[model samples]
Target chain A: MSTGAKKRIMREYGECMSDTPPGMKITFDEQNMTEWEILLDGPEQSVYAGGHFKLKLTFPNEYPFKPPVVSFKTKIYHPNVSNDDKGSMCLGLLRPEEWKPPNKVVAVLRLIQTLLIEPNPDDAIEPSIANEYKENRKEFDKTAKDWVKRYAK
Target chain B: MDPAGQHRDMMYCHECHDEWYRDEHGLTCPECGSDFTEIIEEDHDPRDHDDDDDDSMPDLEDHHPQHPLHHHDPFQPADDPEEGDISRLQWRQVGPGRFSVTGTVYRTVSPHGQGRDDGGANALGGFASILNNMIGGAARGQPAPEDAVHRFSYTSSARLAPRDAINPQAHMEPVDEMTNVLVGLMATFGEAPGGPNAQHPHGHPPHANGPGGGQMPFHPILALLNGMRPGNGTMGDFVYSQEGLDRIISQLMEQTQSSNAPGPASQQEIDALVRKPVTTEMLGSEGRADCSICMEEVNIGEEVTELPCHHWFHHPCVAAWLAEHDTCPHCRQGISKHERPSNTADGNTGASGVNNHGQMPGSFAMGDGPANDATLVQENWENSGSSQQDSSSGGIGDRIRRGLFGPPHR
Candidate 1:
């Protein structure tokens, strides 16, 4: 990593440790400085209320300048989240052009929490789920809760 | 002036090369339904003439509306091509006859918008018409009037009247679009017995359009830009848009800004940095072995500059840094105490004096070297805080005092 990136990462790591987000915990990989493990318990108000989801965030050498890559390791059913082996979650803020230097991992965690609470059905990667959420809200909640109970227990 | 039987607007289909009334089929051709219909206004549409002589057209469909069977009004005015989208119309017809065909090498470099409606009074006189006809010559680069460009897309095309066709000579004004085009071409390529184009400026043409002809006529470029690129056009015709003009200018500004930021360091500044010949004996256990900037080990017999902060680096590397910042890259220590201007030198004193809880200026400047005038300045710099008040010309001692106390306020 470049000196600027390394210094900023250490600073960001220090800041994130000081104040962890609500219902979320951040843990760094012992050997790799760039990789971080986030254990996120779904908000009580959301569909996946009692679910515990594990997520991985790997930052490039140019953090702040380049946005980190976020993917769900735990199985989940949601719109905007791609249903694939990569389990990549696409957020507007995480886009390369939109990612700013000042945004930290805590901000990303907050966005992910709010995204689960109020899913955007319009710009969805999983169009089937988005359609279900829009047209039939009851069926979408039932399917989402079922997936959380089966896989994210 | 007779409106009846005049072809107001015509759509020329690119696929079938058929003309249509825009009001009937809209933007596309009715026969082919092709949207690539170039708006055209023919004076006496040859199709209208072809209808008069049925032998000229081989139409198998007896009930075709375009035929005399389903007779339509020919004199109806054509709808505006750019009616809904006026901003979509990129170029404006400046004064006509500005853009002349310079041989076959015709190219427009930039856009200009001026004198758009002013040129119709002196319009295309005969002498200018002769020059408009002359084409085959080497063309020079000229500033294109930005008032309009590629204007042939959306303009009121003059359709031929039945009366004008019967008596063509009666309405053949020098400024007429047809005569402007014909005379411009004649002035451009018509190098014959009465080669008015080749001889008008040289006063070699006949008496009618001689030296005392009319006002010097504008070229076809300014007079009639429609003659430049006559063809079928779509919505994307205006490529050099006004919005694109700003992008070109911003790119130019960015190029100049980057050039000024890091002006190449002068050779003399590189040679003048306080340096010492590197030796194996000087490698102290307390000091770092490698240069922080390049991260290279200090080789024996190589010259090095140990800054006032006790941090040593390669002479080439540190001198290159000091030329711009005048500070140590690793420790943020001052390289030269009095090198900068009175204002910035005061700022540096702020950093140096406050480095260790804002106590000592002596330890910063006189780190490892022998005592000199620099040491004496640091000794009294603290007491003589207002150096300007102490002396009229501001002596070294008074300046040193200002430097000492300047850090606290900063």
Candidate 2:
């Protein structure tokens, strides 16, 4: 990473430290500052209430120019999150084309919280899960809550 | 038999043409020690049934005329045709889901039987129908015929169809026309012409004989066809052992997606953006803000490049991003060259480089310009959203959603 990208990441880390999003703890390592481990508490309004989800946010060499990659380290039964081991999230601004250099890591954290509150079934990564969320809300919520207890506890 | 207490099968070594009992000598040839040996089934051996050997042999030949034992040379004719050479369009499944077609020309002394003619006719009909469906669809801008879809679905099974089912001489009447049509059809769905999408596997650049639109460029299909010498006759008969039509169509479909994706901004557009110093009036309420690109605080008097959309960033920062995409980083408004500078900015529009530094004629032209700029930015964001919806949704939320699903559901 360039000095500019590294400086930006450091500044963003400082900003996140001063004012981290509610129920989220960001751990930044100076040795490898590009990758940050985040512990996110599932929103109270959502089906995954009381569950703790671990997420990894890794900045690219392009840093602010290119959007950071976000992946679910803890399994979450959500429409937007992948069902596989990677648990990758790639919707919206995460897309290389849609991502703007102006976008901040704070906005990304807030977006994740917003998604947790209400998963966007329309742009879901897991179609079956999205379908369940749309067609069978009860089943979707039940399974999501069950997974929260089983995997995210 | 000495140790395993089982009967030993007879094995033949193809390398040395030697036979041995497996229990005594194993699978390897006992004489030459070659491992290229096959187990000879006791019941399948011709020498085992000598009583009615002639009758069984003739029946076997009748059933499998193209068998390696019957016709050692692929170029040798199975049956004699009266006149010129018969060109059989040979289609082979070169790999999993990839089929390559070649013409194999051969001659025979005497005319063949009605059975062979009937088989040839059937194969010809199947091939003709497939070609007709594809050509007819392309001409009318309609979906390919249902029969072609069915044939493509069963290509794997069709690959195992009797070799006699591929005799191409029965429909020699339309040889010239069919050859042209074959060439045309292959070109229509082949590689794209002279662009990033062009991928010629055999290093043969696209040929110019496209009977269809410019969208169709002659490809490896033509290269494969040209490689063959359909001997002594213009008869270009066709047989698809495994249909590659679907594969080609799917590839074309795949190309169309990326073909529409927004390309990088040209150099001229990137250089045209205005460079202005950071001002408190521009910063407004907070009186402090970071350049979103580099996340460094841009205090008053610091130089920053301002995009036509009114969103400003560090010159190097926005320039690097603009090289990859044309849209404003904040609002995604394309700094399209088509955008005309407003009449109000005419006083500042001298040819001198410093005169154009005020702002581009977009949101800055409004009567309530600075206050209304936020709303204009918001509206531009929505415009960008709707435009991106065609390719993919924008916003970190929608991007995450779209990214999860991959490609529009369409």
Give the true-contact fraction for every prediction, in order: 0.00, 0.50
Interface RMSD of each: 20.0, 6.9
Q: Candidate 2 chain A, which ten residues in sequence have the lowest lDDT sum?
A: A95-104
| DockQ of each two-chain model | 0.01, 0.19
Cα deviation of A9 in candidate 1 (Å)? 2.1
What TM-score goes with each of the models? Answer: 0.32, 0.48
True contacts kept of 2: 0.50
Tens-digit lDDT track of model 1 for B262-287: 22334564565558766544453333
CA displacement after TM-score superposition, residue B334 of candidate 2 (Å): 2.9
> Which runs of model 2 end up more than 4 angstroms from their true locations?
B1-261, B339-380, B383-410
Model 2, span B260-358: residue lDDT tens: 224567888788778888776555334455566776667789888887646677888888887876666664555666433322123332322122222
For A44-120, candidate 2 gives per-residue lDDT tens digits of: 99998999999999999887777899999999999889999999887666766556675567767777877898787
Model 1 TM-score (2 dp):
0.32
Q: Which ten residues in a row have the lowest lDDT in candidate 2 chain B?
A: B145-154
